[model samples]
Target: MSQTSHFTKVNRRDLLSAGAALIGAAATGLAFEPKASAEKPSTGATHTEPSATAPNYAPPIVQIQGGQLRGYRDGKTTVFLGIPYATAERFELPKPVPPWQGIKSAQSWGPVCPIPPMAHVGIDEFVFPHRYWVEDEHCQILNIWTQSTSASAKKPVMVWLHGGGFTNGSAMEAYAYDGKNLSEFGDVVVVSLNHRLNILGTLDLSAYGPEYAQSRYTGTADILAALQWVQANIAQFGGDPGSVTLFGQSGGGSKAARMLHTPSAKGLFHKVVTQSGGGEVLADQDPAALLKIQQQIAAQTLANLNLTGSDISKLKTIPYLDLITAGQAALRSVAQANNQRAGWNVIADDNYILRQFCDWSSDIPQMSGSVFSEMSSNYVKSIDKNSWTPQQVNEHLTAEFGDKKDAIAAAFKTSFPRKQVQDVLFFARPNTRALAAKAQAGHASVYNYLFVYEYPVNGGTTSFHTAEIAFVFHNLTEPQVRVATGDASEGYALQDKVSRAWINFAYTGNPSQPGLDWKPFSDADPQTMVFDTVSECRNIHAKELIALLPPPPAPRF
Candidate 1:
């Protein structure tokens, strides 16, 4: 079973050209500053124009931690961007980024971290609209938004991590990820960040050199470092450090789950929300089997490039383009050999990554759920050009489930009789139940949901994996969605109800919104909020579905 070659499967040069076009749109004008020299709150400050650079952008300059900070007022909310938390070295583990001089304008969003674009392959569920552009090592930064008109309204903080499968994506992708809506709508301060990824972030080489020893989990370490920075500096931006909530969708949820058990992130956050995401708990193979492939790739890269010394500095000096080319080649080789899962996955490195990620936070309260047809429906959209037959769907089921193929296929056939074979093959029979089951096992005050508000596509494509993101961010009419779904406001009312529920959940442990009251999951009923054209809470997946899905293993961390 060879790994799919997403790299060479597409034309690299053409993809890079498309990538360059995306980078042009990535630049945004927002900013933030450290809060060293704090300023007292002025309740009724007039909105006056500052200098030429900040004509329409007028925010009170607050001093905290020996640094002056400025925030811009947009409508009823104040927004900030590009706040530096930690400074990372070129291809080095993240360290404390030094404080800057004077008032640093956090008015514009910073550059995104680097990754190659999978352009040849058409868009799928996870491919966001942002450019897959690469940037410098100084890419570690955060964005902030607050609804407090005064500088003294200490609001609860919601820290977000953008999902790109630990490879590509940033905090500045869509306006939906922006803090303005969350801050104003929920009356809470929102913060998002961009961190290292792919080979630059997750190439384990500890078995080779001491320099590589401390660099095993560089990507996760970068996230932990970012959280630590928030703890030290969020209070300056009118955020409560003691009441920070960490949440994300898809890859972001996976990162959040990893942080839940990470020793370094013990007290950094108090609440967790994982939507349509799970950690690396699949019980197929051991992590060490994949790690060996990464070490071999690194060794081959050094030897082929003729770098004898073990110092990473020499490796760092290599040109960016060359590194990308070599990394792609390494990935292709791994895929062809079917060594393990593709390159740069989180490995269980004894210290940082204790065990396969499982839901073991029974002691603490947690909220978890996924879209009803997350991976299943997304697969249908991915292979729209080709049609699949029932035999084809059954064959795929055999491949994916091995000994349990017949039961899984039968379940999908019985559950969705009229669905296309592609839908049955991809979305109708995925591991969505496993995600909810894993979380429920931990006794964490867990809640679940099935986002069923189908985005009305022309033919019969329903709401897919990422359909709720734009709505949750209060950007139902965003440029991206408008382009995809012609009828933009079809799900507007549903969006309003669901987004508010998410914000309310972030504030209190419950998803108790103004008009909607969602019950938390329990042993007797396992309450789930099904967000359709009209929202309601109930166990949509019947007892048969639950019985078909096996129970998840308890977390070992």
Candidate 2:
């Protein structure tokens, strides 16, 4: 925990010197040359260069630790797709991939980690266009988009973690995750990656033997390994390794929060951003309880597969699909017996990740926020938004809030007088206040924001889960984004403002941009930036409402 043990701080002077040395090396024959542009080949491949107008177009190639990679070009950005950072055996720590002899074509996305199909879920179903991909265990790959391929560029780095809890989701699960626009617009290096998940990543075997002592945290360790790789090699892609920021949404946000307390992830990143997935007090699990759950699932899985304890090693060799099916069956069995839902995912374990949500004395700056309405109105079907009555809203509120419905409704209406009853019903005040309270208690500088941008889809789902993604990445023109937000001109304007704030945060710890004066959250006022059409900072604590609500759920892991 000592500061001396953290990564040596690389000052501006050191970065300049390193950049100068890289340029000098490149002047000689030490560094590889940029690939020469060529005309379209007769093969007519998808990655072929355009020959008529942009005849001089050629993908930029960079030399990494493993080998040379030829990445495609997108206007000002150079994108290296499907670059492997690490490899691992089933349920084991990741190891750096062996260096190759020749250039590797990094032109397309790599296979994603196998995840159960969840398109039937309404939220995912809406974003289904971005979900399909070839899934495989060779999923430990990263995608990078940089404005400069020169090592001397020294741009700030931003690594994105995808948001499918520990169980599902991939780096490119959503079109909003694409880094081309963000990297180009911010003039910063953007990176995202895929890692093991579900049973393959989080199955805890430490109770069985010392060899598996770290099993509970392999998924997180894979992220650590990716960060380590970034620290060592990102400079080659014009990134300043010393100024890296870890940012994510939903599950990815929780992972980012986990890294804040993880010893291995210490110093690998300088700043953190958690959107919607910030408060997971239950991230860590009691070892005995976790072991019991794992054992129960293991027994059921083995019985289903007609295998005994002696065939344990064979579990690793089973088809990935079969493993998922067995894991699901075991989880259902355990959940039924224990009268609770069960999952095989990241456990605090108290080894890699300490048993704390936020460390008051830690120096890492953090930014956490949730959408204005997440999973609130999405559950309602066939409801007439235009003809809905206030009585209907009150009835639904009574059903959800019980005896305190009127008190909560009155408080919410007082704060946002213009908002509809449905809007008041789905307001994310409770969870957002809880997250802000945790962040304010920490010693580090903490900023909170509420994404209030309403999507013009599904009869206007206002700031629903994942709605802020397109704006954050400045990807309003993406296909799925257009489907979600019609007439994207307004969305584009908001995207510019929001993405600039994010870029500013990555560059410096402060997220304040030109027109936006984003103040840090304080325990007294608890200010939050309301990211709406006119974006303004506001205090969000309806003290009476918050006090009436039950205490936030306890850590469940």
TM-score of each: 0.76, 0.84
Instruction: Put down candidate 1 lDDT per residue, 297-319, tens digits, no spaces.
Output: 66656655666545546766676
Give model 2's TM-score versus the native structure.
0.84
Off by over 4 Å in 2: 1-57, 117-124, 127-129, 282-287, 357-361, 379-382, 389-406, 432-442, 547-557
lDDT against the true structure, each candidate: 0.65, 0.77
Superposition error at 255 for model 1 (Å): 0.8
Q: Local error of candidate 2 at 261, Å?
A: 1.8
Cα lDDT tens digits, model 2, 1-557, are: 11122358667578998788788878895864443577554576556545755612555778888889888877777888999999888778899999998889898898788886564645445632465687877688999999887889899999999987899889998888999889978999999999888877887765456767787677888899999999989999999999999999988998888786677776799888998885766443575686677768767877788888777778767877677788888888888898766886565656677666535326777788888767654424534453468777777778778998777777777665556655665666535543554554566678888887766665666667787888888887877767766555677888888899899999988999878888888667678887877787778655655676555454442
Q: Which run of 10 residues does model 2 get worst, by summed lDDT?
A: 1-10
Model 1 segments beyond 4 Å from truth? 1-57, 121-128, 131-134, 149-152, 282-287, 303-312, 356-360, 375-426, 430-443, 483-490, 522-526, 542-557
